[model samples]
Target chain A: MTDARRPLQIVDPDDPRIAAYRGIRERDLVRHQKRFIAEGTSVLRVLAGQRRFGIESALILENRFAGVADILGMLPAKTRVYVASSDVIDAIAGFPMHRGVLAVGLRRDDADAAPDTARRWRTVVALSEIANHDNMGAIFRNAAALGADAVLMDAQSCDPLYRKALRVSVGAVLTVPWHRFGHADAMLDWLETNGFALAGLSPRGDAALEHWEPPAKAALVLGTEGPGLPDRVMDRTQTLRIAMANGFDSLNVATSAALVLHHVRNARTGPASG
Target chain B: MTDARRPLQIVDPDDPRIAAYRGIRERDLVRHQKRFIAEGTSVLRVLAGQRRFGIESALILENRFAGVADILGMLPAKTRVYVASSDVIDAIAGFPMHRGVLAVGLRRDDADAAPDTARRWRTVVALSEIANHDNMGAIFRNAAALGADAVLMDAQSCDPLYRKALRVSVGAVLTVPWHRFGHADAMLDWLETNGFALAGLSPRGDAALEHWEPPAKAALVLGTEGPGLPDRVMDRTQTLRIAMANGFDSLNVATSAALVLHHVRNARTGPASG
Candidate 1:
């Protein structure tokens, strides 16, 4: 086989080709021009595992490149693998990236291509107005760990592809299949049309989470922390709540999502007492 | 009753009486000299509700003081309540004080004052090597929200009373009864002596968390994110796993604690479907 994917030494941090990876925190504030930064070895591995997200280029600290050769080999011959010293890599990213691995992945913008629900999805998550990046990332991590098929978020929700969220997710955000829709009601309606039961997680839910079993196809809905699911959304879906201790009804939304997702996954597969 | 607990208006942010609250973040790095800062209205409420933790003083934004009259009224007559402009409060904190509510609480020093377990506690959580402040805070929040009676962390763990932790926990850190012990084994031994079945959470656990039912008095032990519970500790107790989805065995430590704590709580009180 031809050694086409040799690593390029990046002595200068300001190389124009690697501009997509500069000042990551500030750059993440605006839309990334259809590209997302995947940080750390774990996230890079996930990004390399999938073909849907095209790997445009990778910047790695020289010391860490050897550890990730197998993953790098998975990329196309055109993919630029730029190797730099620790200081150069840190300078490029504008932060101390001790993990020493970063990659830029391109997103597929084809909204018209419908998801193959029958084969690819069964249990899905729908998030409404989840503004916190950490919470959004944690939800993706929980969804991946607990066997949720995909995630659907309304436009109001924070972008799961944001740097901190991607890092917090341990790269699950890169691997998990997720889509964004315009409105909460439209997302719920889409799930309904696709033969999925929409279960909205709320403090004022009518059914206790422990008693609620997932249908063959279920969409677990979560909302922002304090305001929770809007009455309009709650009115359209079956509401469920994790029965908390009487005096303390609050749990971080991510923790709430994990418990709910785990319950749904277990309920569908078998009893909770596996 | 006399208006002896009147709020004192302080224009100077450098007032020595509120020195415990100065440079809050930096002060949190070193120990608070046996004191902790509780932030936000909710934590202040919990601080005021308890007599066990001595309320040394409170600092509030002038605009927010009227909103917390009930909580302020609960403080002892000698407790000083300092009121200042939002800018002064922010400057004093070395950060923006949007919530505009803060209180300094003194932790009880006597380890011999045994916990009133006979009437209040049936379930407890013990943590080993949990160094993350956010994780510690989340665990405290989870413990309080899910009915776990107390938190026992090994000395290696970060302080739960750190400002960020206290804030992240939404003041749950202040409300949850917790203690730090010398070693992991010693804490576990103490739990055993107190009639608790120590269940250590590990990825290599001998039993699946779904099938493992908690005993009447269970102590759920959690470790740090990576290099989970040490084998020495795991060898001494019944170990259990959350049974994550294949290929993804990761969940934030706080989320893991929440799930295990929820399972143990429900198992003891009722079925998982309660």
Candidate 2:
């Protein structure tokens, strides 16, 4: 590895090499830059293991590097690693960052990112117009944990690769296959052509989730919290409702999705596989 | 009601009447004051309908007051309602509270807060050492949505009435019966004496969650995210596990709680009740 590409020490917060990492807290820096900031030791480790996305560089506190040097070495030697004091990191980030470890990950392209039809996904989590990053991240985390094969988000939904979303996902976003492109209607048509059952979750559904058995291939669709799936979307898919307490509001979108996915997976393969 | 007790107008940020609402974002003000701050119109509505706790006061932005005046009327005439401009409200809160609705709720006494045996709660959610307010709040929300009768927290758990937890719960904490006092072991003993199955959730448990039939009455206990329920507690209960994909981590504590509670309820009474 070249000297310029090796691990470097950063003393000044205003170092031009780490300019992209500045003002991270003040705005959506990563999304606008077509990259993402992965925080904490665990997320950084995930960024290193995957080749689907590029790990641009990393910034770690001096004391924390000894424990994580092995993980950081996993990244290509060309990936610049900057070690700094806590004060310099806090200054560069525009606030105190307790995690001390941060890395900027380059997102992959959108073309041909859909699931392979040949493999025939058992469960696909479909989310529409999910605006909150926390919910989006939690959905991805649930999709991965409950054994969903892929995660498909409509164009209206927020980016799963958003900094906070990736962090909340506990690095599942790096592992899970997700695509946030194309019209949802087109995606529904594709799923239908693939012989997949499209199950839309709603409070006013025709079938209770408990009674609706999972088919060999299925796409579970969920919408934003307040409005839920629109009329057109609901009409196109079989609606499934989770039983709620008398007149109580619906469960959190991600929570409901977990229950649905867990049930569908268990019903299909039995809980012993869980 | 006296004229002095009527809804009053305040233009100053430092007004002593609204001082308790100030610096809300800075520290754990509500917990220190032995009160909780409820935000948003939806939560305010839930607080208004419940008589278990006392409503001490409210602060609302001038523009948003007209839409909620009727709900405000639901409170007693003596409840102090302070109307303030957006600028003053933001200044007093030390941050912008977009919902424009805030209220201070006085907590009730803990004496005899345990579940009533005569009613025979179908399901109970018992948590151990849950520290995050967001997870804590989500647990209560799930308990309410999935029809868990009450929430019992071990001594190490954080307060559900903390402002952020209350907001995340969507006022479920206000409506749900919860007790934070007493040793977990004693509570487990009481639950067993009352003919309840003590099911402890863990990844390394003996019984798969799907295989374990929901008894007539059950108490489902979960722990925090990383280090799950202590071994001492796990040894005292029947272990139940949610199957995970190969080498994957466990689901969020709150998400798992929702799945368990939803399953227990549906199994006991069937999904038609959902």
TM-score, chain B, predicted structure 1: 0.91
lDDT for each residue of candidate 1 in B1-274, tens digit (9 for 90 to 100): 2252588888888988778888988888885358888888988998888766788888989999889998888888888898999988988999898989998888777521255443456788889999888898888889888988888888898888787787788777766777778888788888888788888888888888888868888888899878999989898889998878878987889899899887877677674343
User: What do the candidate models score in CA lDDT, each in turn?
Assistant: 0.83, 0.83
Q: CAPRI verdict on model 1?
A: medium
> Candidate 1 on A150-238: residue-level lDDT in tens?
88989899888898898889988877788888888888888888898889998888888887878888899999889999999999999
Considering only N, C-alpha and C atoms within 3 Å, which residue pairs clash in candidate 1? Answer: none
TM-scores for all candidates: the values are: 0.90, 0.94
Shift in Å, residue A151, candidate 2: 1.0
> RMSD in angstroms, all models?
3.0, 2.5
Off by over 4 Å in 1: A1-15, A61-70, A83-91, A95-99, A110-113, A116-120, A272-274, B1-13, B62-70, B85-87, B111-120, B271-274
Model 2 C-alpha lDDT per residue in residues A1-274, reported as the tens digit of each score: 3432356899999999998789887556334356679999988888888887888899998889887887887888678889999999999999899889999888657422555632657788888889799998899889888888888877788877788888888888988887765678877887787778899999998899898888788999999889999898999999999888864877899999899988987898766733
TM-score of chain A of each: 0.91, 0.92
- Residue A79 of model 1 has an lDDT of 85
